[model samples]
Target: MKQDIILKRIEEKLKVLKKARPFPPYLVKKLREQFSLEMNYNSNAIEGNTLTLRETMLVLQQGITIKGKSLKDHLEAKNQAKAIEYLYDIVDSKKDIPISEMLIRNMHSLVVQNIDGVEAGSYRAHDVRITGSKHTPCGAFEVPQKMHELISWHKKNKDNLDIITLATEFKHRFVHIHPFGDGNGRVSRLVLNILLMKQGYPIVVILKNEREKYYRALQKADNGNMEDLVFFIAQAVERSLDLYIRAIESSTKENSLVSLSKIAPQTKYSAEYLGLLVRTGKVAGVKDGRNWKTSLDAIEQYEMNLIRKKK
Candidate 1:
């Protein structure tokens, strides 16, 4: 799909999400905790952290050490949970925390605190090369200066660019700079969500299963082709929005309980196709014995996502 069209659909969904906000405090907390576990697990997993989602949750929630995982693996989960909490604290502060060098450094520090304190919050002191990529990071001496430039560019263009584009650009450039010796990927993802949260959007979790595509998008951004990265981020945002919409709709409406056959007539898709989607887990739903039961909103979101993908 074209970047502009993808972004327009994301913006439309974001508007719907904004109107659905001020979800009950309890629901909000529950969602945050759930996302924290998923984000921490996926983000760390992308960086070679070996903790499974259940293992990460066990470490974070129950403080139970998995028998075979490395200390660094456990620490990565704990540190990322802390970093996510820090992000939320900033979001809930009602204080304007502009994207700055300090904020970036602090987040990086939280990410690497237990693993590498010496360089946790500081920029690298030597040139670094990213593995499996042709792009070279700026020299250590240039990291500070380039970071300042990045912050300035964000401040200047934030109002001019749409949120998805702005967040994608920031992630692309930040990773391109490769300021820190470690935790760059994790920190970049956190910062991306921070930018989205600042704009009243839900956090986008880039799954570990998407590692290759995620890396490819970043590499494309490095090559001055940002369309791929933008589209990738848009899809993630759309997924989160769909989750929010489904959750909210399910809570408020009694009409959420419906069979695939019933929603088929309301959508352009055939019942067989809708049933196929349910069986394949493309649509969010529960099974009532042999039949697939799902919410109307889920069908709507599924159709909208399909339309966006085709465009």
Candidate 2:
């Protein structure tokens, strides 16, 4: 099939997906902020310098530094959030442009940041491989040709799929190709959220507890069965929606549930500065915990503390 035709088919399928999943106002607000936070977190994690889930949370809440003991530990612990944050930035841009070279570079840059022996912000010209689950394939799988084909194929047929499913398939294919020497899982998940956030969905964080089930779903997809993959992605979307809904509901009672876009203007600082603060462990309130459960008051206090320290 022609690449354009295949892409169009995928896009049409995405339209159906949109119809299948719709978001209300509160959910939209919650998703906007949460996904942004998550993308930043994931991007940092992938580069071999990350905090634990708890430490990341504290970074968001109290702005306390919870450094990793070493490079491997940091990457293993924080890569997921770092990669997702990378995705959020791409998909959440206000430029109204299609995903382009700039975005890919940005994602790659984040994926390789602070990692040892990895060229941060560059694609691997070297060979890559995907190690399957124990129950799945045992042999080490090479991915150079596969990744090149996928990218070329995506460009050829991008129009066929809406930005959302394009992101989803990209995520799937990224992991399938395992293009990087390490951190493929983190990058792939981040790429997925980039697409989802672009489509106006919240960032979906699969908890450590559910990691096995998540792997199993992907394993099924690897075996030429997409039912589980489709189901799992759909469920992730649904959970993202549910997370935002809960956040809105919980915040509404306290009259603190303001939309992120709206808050962006009223604050004394730019989002970029806040993001840096977030990275350095000096601010709080983000979209995580399958919902925006992080406390806004805590965020406020953390920011205030930063202000005092800066003086």
Candidate 3:
């Protein structure tokens, strides 16, 4: 029932976003660049990559290497950028592109190319356990069949499930399968974005700062409870949509999206309260670098919602 309401909100915001399309080319490029960097840095960081966000920007944008970071770290950043670019090409060029094992392998290959050349894209040959997690992935010999099953399951459910539900469930299933020797989480996120982008959703970044929450949701998902995971992902998808709406709608007298500190003074919510609200998805906003940003309009909507609930 809760998922139904959230999904409705997502679809509604998505409708508003779509009508604003064809968005300006410059806006598309700028937003793409922001999401690409955030996705690359945050996804890699969650998997224990050591590059800081700013360092990642240097590696990705300036072709400059960080002095203390490992060569593998630099490559992971570079490779992820390339992989996401490949993803965008396929997503934009093809309509309803079929998801296949080949596509998954290609994405993994692009992700871990220089870091693990031999098994860059291949399923592991031996069973493995996730470090610091209670779940044990399928046995080594089972990976091939498991992945095939995953693809088949996707085929069966693609049209039946909501896209966000499909994407989050796929994230859990793919990581739980642990098909590749490495880079499963990264690949899962890429696959998630492909599923979303095809459906006209903006690129979703699972923030590295939210790593604990993300893993907790996944843990809940492992036990067959999908609500936490879906809600987490729904928040992320909504954040991306907020960015699109803010960009497209910024030109008018409409409320402008600014950092929480900037907009808090204009509303009843304190900076601290607004931060908590955005972080928890009680209100719609965005994470801009290290700072949280929102608008008076978002708070107004939240207030209206609160009043309606009280009545």
Candidate 4:
């Protein structure tokens, strides 16, 4: 039931975003800049990069290296940003772009260019295991064949499946393939957003703060369960949608995310309870630092559902 509501909201937001095209140049520039920073920071952070979101902005936009951060961390930020730009460049220049293995390798090459120079774009040459998971990655010899099968699977189902399911499944499958020696998670996310962008959906960021939950969801998918993983991706997609719409419309009251305490006053629930709902996936909200933020619009939807359930 919660998943349905979340997916429905995603469609609604996506529809709004689609109708707003051809998006203005300024809007595109604004959003692309913000999402670039977001993708660079959060994706690297998930893989244990230590740069805070602000520090990421400094490194990418201002080229100011932090005193204590490792050069590798800075390189990860810059490399990931370039990977994001590469995707945007292709999406802008091409029409009906099919995601091919070549494109995947190209993105991987950008992701690990200097970090892992020798094997930047090549598939791993040895067996790899997912940390803290029961599923073992395919042997090095199988990476090529498995990746070929993955591309084939995507081609076969790309159009038939809904957008979230298609992108999310492709992401998990890519990470499951674990083709690269390192940077699989980061590359998987980059490719995932490219697929989303190809279909006109916004860049979906799996949050750094939710890193543990994200992994657990993947582990479950490895065990043949995908519901949790789908919703996790869905929430991120919707959040981006919220941001784009709020920016485009310049109307934050209903679309913008506010602290839970502010949102709680508008509904019958208390802030702590709403936080619980956010954590348990009963409502749509985002983790901002130590606090959780939700929109009044989401709480209203929850209340409306409650009324319907009673009737």
Candidate 5:
């Protein structure tokens, strides 16, 4: 009975999400395809629950594996992966790990394991700055010593503030510190996801395709306008939900048009529930087919939509 009530509540929440946008069927189809491609790529190995360190390394290297690197050099690219996995394990333990002095050194130590001149787990005594891109002005920035206060503020406000907001803010600060000589971007994202996953949210992979938007959002955060960061994260989260939902929905469709009947000891079918599924793009009927299939992203989106109420 309790489970049934919870499921009903989920259904209601999805109904609200579905009604938020009356997306055209063609738009839904396009979004589903995008979701399918990304989710499939992400789930290839590292993004899945049963992630391997090596696999995670390969995935991260995919970001830096540029036009000039040899296959051997690329395959040996394991430092970032090792660092991220080690940090993931540490953070996943749910310990109240110190973030200020410890996190930078710890992350830097891990980042430089295979790189040259980067002392394992040490911060630069001297100042460091990034070269200007077309979007950024060329200027040397002294790494702010203010991170001590920032981390302290985070620890104190971690509970009171929204986890997504806090996580995004933390990432912004890490990048601003430019703590490490290199690998700062990857480390910061890994740290953000670690916080997010610990908070029970899914790991959001900001795809290469969305780099412009991602960078712009980061810029907004850097400039002290956090709303852009929040909006960006929300959109990414929603996109992830869309992908997972479509994948699950696709699986259900493959099994049968009516998968609920496959749920063991099923109760009477709810027409309202079926309608909700259709509205949310969880179920789709082919022109010549009698049955509908549930896309994985659709189902996952529905689940996440329900989870928002808990917040």
Candidate 6:
């Protein structure tokens, strides 16, 4: 699919979600804790941290270290949680914090503060090569200049590009520079999300299961083709949008609603078809456990709109 079309669909869902923003404080708290655990686990896991999701939760929440797990692994989980908290602080701040070299460095420092204090917030002094890849990062001496250029580019083009494009391009360029000797991947992901959250979009989580595919997308971006990466990132954003939308819908009190299966007999569409519509935000509905529940009136309204479009 074309990037513009996918982005347009994402924007449509975002509109619905934005209207429901400042989600109930309890829901907001729940989402924050949930995404923090998932994000920390996945981000660190992709970097070869040995902690599983459950183990990460244990380390972060209970301070219960796993037997035989490396201290670095525990620290990675803890530091990432701190980094996530910092990201949210920036997002919630009264003052707007534009993306900058300092912001990037601060985030990197948070990621590796305990593991490598000397180089935590500092750029590398030696050239580095990415393992298992053909891309060579800028020389150590050129790191500062390249990072300056990246920030300038963001300021110049942020308004012209859509949020997904802007964030994905920034991630690609940042990783391409590989400014830091270590923790570049973690910092890149944090910066990508900072750009997104600043624009009011939900944070995108790159799952550990997608490790190979995510690397391939970055490689493709290095080759000057960023469509795959943009789509990959967009899908994650879409999932976040779906979660928020479903939560908002379920919270509202309404009568005369029924499951898609029950409404199927009253409309021309099958339950499967209506379920697809609900999932894609084409119809108004709430997901009730395993089933999509919606009002018959919503289905009728959607049918009427389709008829009008056809005419």
Question: What ranges in model 2 sit over 4 Å off?
Answer: 1-51, 59-68, 71-86, 100-102, 125-145, 156-166, 249-311
Per-residue lDDT of candidate 4, residues 108-182 (tens digit): 999988884448888889888877678898888999999999999998998798888888999999999899888
Residues 27-65, candidate 3: write the lDDT tens digits. Answer: 566689988999999999999999999999988889997
lDDT of each: 0.85, 0.55, 0.86, 0.84, 0.53, 0.86
**Of candidates 5 and 4, the better by lDDT:** 4
What would the per-residue lDDT of candidate 1 be over residues 1-311, giving only the tens digit for each residue? 57888778778887887775545343465578888888999999998888899999999999999998999898888899899999998877788988889999999999999684448889999888898788999889998899999999998999998888999999889999999988899999999999998888887899999999988988888889988999999989888888887776664354576887887788888889877776665666655667766667767776788899999
lDDT of 2: 0.55
Better of 4 and 6 by lDDT: 6
Error of 2 at 58 (Å): 3.0
Query: Model 6: C-alpha RMSD to truth?
Result: 11.8
Per-residue C-alpha lDDT of model 5 across residues 221-265, encoded as one tens digit per residue: 667787877667656655555554554355334444444334212
lDDT of 2 by residue, 121-233 (tens): 55555765445363421223434456567768778867796554566667766676665556666666666765566666667654444556777877776776655565556
Q: Supply candidate 3's per-residue lDDT for 187.
A: 95
| TM-score against native, each model | 0.80, 0.58, 0.80, 0.78, 0.54, 0.80
Candidate 5 TM-score, true structure as reference: 0.54
Residue 32 lDDT in model 4? 87
- Model 2: weakest 10-residue lDDT segment is 134-143
For model 1, what is the C-alpha lDDT against the true structure?
0.85
Counted clashes in each candidate structure: 0, 23, 0, 0, 24, 0
Q: 134-217, model 6: which lDDT tens digit per residue?
A: 899989999999999999999999999988999999999999999998999999999989999887887778899998889898
